[model samples]
Target: MNVAGARENVGSLVVHQSGIQCFNCKEFEHFAKECRKPKRVKDSAYHKEKMLLCKQAEQGVPLQAEQYDWLADTDEDIDEHELEAHYSYMGKIQEVPTADTCTNSEPLE
Candidate 1:
């Protein structure tokens, strides 16, 4: 006749009526797995910057001028010029294949 004792006897697999809280929003009434809130997104740029800093620290050398500039500039100042410079600098660092390097193509007729 005791519902609480009967529920306890039934086992812990049964969801409790209270004390459940969502990890996402830290709210009550729902478990984290059942939370309706959207998952948090990771900041890829921040992580990449951190990784670069770690690499620099391991090498015991200061960051390149462009990287130093990038780190010093605020997010709001990332205009077209800054982006172009970043891309150009990256291009200089990485070697890209040109038409002359293509070995699979026939000569022009």
Candidate 2:
């Protein structure tokens, strides 16, 4: 092959290997990975804001509902004091059953 033809082939191979292409900016014959743009916090902030806006757009509607469902069966017979006493008595007590107290006994599966 001619020297100029060989050089062109080599250049093509280099470009393919480097994964370089330009769509937005033409000054650098490469993609965003090889971009020369100055790093800015605003760029990341813009992306975050864009994501939040997209999410809000997805969930556009607000929902409203009653705190308690009136149609559901309500238990009014159990008083608050009785329930509090039952729970408090349970908290103060630890029941070690007398039958299981033996250390030499084999554990029943």
Candidate 3:
């Protein structure tokens, strides 16, 4: 209970949460650093440039179409779609052959 020495107790810092931390939500296994959601960095010009390039590509692509479709879908549905695509892409690495897991591989191939 000594207030004088409290600053010295670095080990007494309390951890309030654990588990995958969502970057967008900002809460533990997942940090904003590991977030799949697109994030803009305030101090980095390189990130701004990358974002501009991505924006340009989105303007040229069917990003609106996909976003509109996804907006109508549930969060779980969207996550399932993204996770499936992610896993399928990972499964296709040249160093390894995985069982045919993805139904839509044309665009990727």
lDDT scores for all predictions? 0.51, 0.39, 0.42
Give the distance in Å from residue 42's predicted Cα in candidate 1 to where it truly belongs.
6.5
- Model 1 Cα displacement at 62 (Å)? 45
Q: Summarize candidate 1's per-residue lDDT along 49-92 as a digit string, tens digits.
A: 54466568678877543345434435555567656655554444
Predicted model with the maximum TM-score: 1
Query: Residue by residue across 1-71, what tens digits does model 2's lDDT show?
Result: 35333222454563232333332243333443345764323233333433444445568733211101211
Q: Please give me the total number of clashing residue pairs in predicted model 2.
A: 0
Which portions of model 2 miss their true places by more than 4 Å?
A: 1-76, 96-109
The stretch of ten residues in a row with the least summed lDDT in candidate 1 is 1-10
Candidate 3 lDDT by residue in tens digits, 1-109: 2444322233877433243344333443344445576653322343233344455566775443323332233344445654565455445434433457656645444
94 Cα displacement, candidate 2 (Å): 0.5
Q: Report residue 49 deviation for candidate 2 (angstroms).
A: 62
At residue 97, candidate 1 shows an lDDT of: 54
Q: Which ten residues in a row have the lowest lDDT in candidate 3?
A: 65-74
Residue 8 error, candidate 2, Å: 99
